[model samples]
Target: MKSVLAHPISQEMDSVAFEDVIVTFTWEERPLQGPSWRNPHKDVIQQILRNLSYIENQWRDQHIENQYKKILSDI
Candidate 1:
């Protein structure tokens, strides 16, 4: 995960192979909104990574919470 989080993410990722099939990803970004989201090089990598981590944590917590709720419901 560190390797994934280490680099900037705004650039196009193209595609990759899983095992039997291939998968692709394409992203076309608009303009960055806030001053903090801006990069002089016209890159939003850092902000993208930050947002990705935030969403990852949020979804992870939500998944765990749902699992707990399910277990509680079984009780």
Candidate 2:
């Protein structure tokens, strides 16, 4: 599994990979926090996004290993 996060302003892609899968997450700065669902604080949103990316990376790593092991066991 491969995961990537793209920064629009910097136009760069931060990526991580595991086995044969890939995933991506991206973020953009928003003003006024328009809706209730939107975070009122930009810092809080940034932290949450970072945590989510980390979790996804860990999950993919474990998942890919499990899949590969299973495939080999079937042989």
Candidate 3:
């Protein structure tokens, strides 16, 4: 499905000077924290873990794709 951002500040530089930026954002109206993140329930903790794993896999895939493109361009 197609997706869109909820905020306009897409890049760090988009903010004005010395603006507090939200590094971790969500499309939902509220952040996904159902309870205390430090002592969250099992389900909340699992969601956090899943998000972390997804981010890691995305980073790995992007890194590999960039390397592949660089190699192809250099050839």
Cα lDDT tens digits, model 2, 19-52, are 4453333455445336663545556669979999
lDDT of each: 0.70, 0.73, 0.75
Q: TM-score for each prediction?
A: 0.45, 0.44, 0.47
Q: What are the RMSDs of all candidates, in order?
A: 16.2, 14.1, 11.2
Q: Name every residue pair that clashes in candidate 2.
A: 1-18, 1-21, 2-17, 2-21, 2-22
The alpha-carbon lDDT assigned to residue 74 of candidate 3 equals 100
Q: Which scores greater on lDDT, model 1 or model 2?
A: 2
Ranked by TM-score, top first: 3, 1, 2
For 1-75, candidate 3 gives per-residue lDDT tens digits of: 998779876456653553464244466934676556635556766997999999999999999999999999999
Q: Which stretches of candidate 3 lie over 4 Å from their true place?
A: 1-40
User: What TM-score does model 3 achieve against the real structure?
Assistant: 0.47
- Candidate 1 residues lying further than 4 Å off, grouped into runs, are 1-39
Across 25-68, the per-residue lDDT of candidate 1 in tens digits comes to 34434343456644542465577678999999999999999999
Question: Compared to the true structure, candidate 2 yields what TM-score?
Answer: 0.44
Give the candidate number with the greatest lDDT: 3
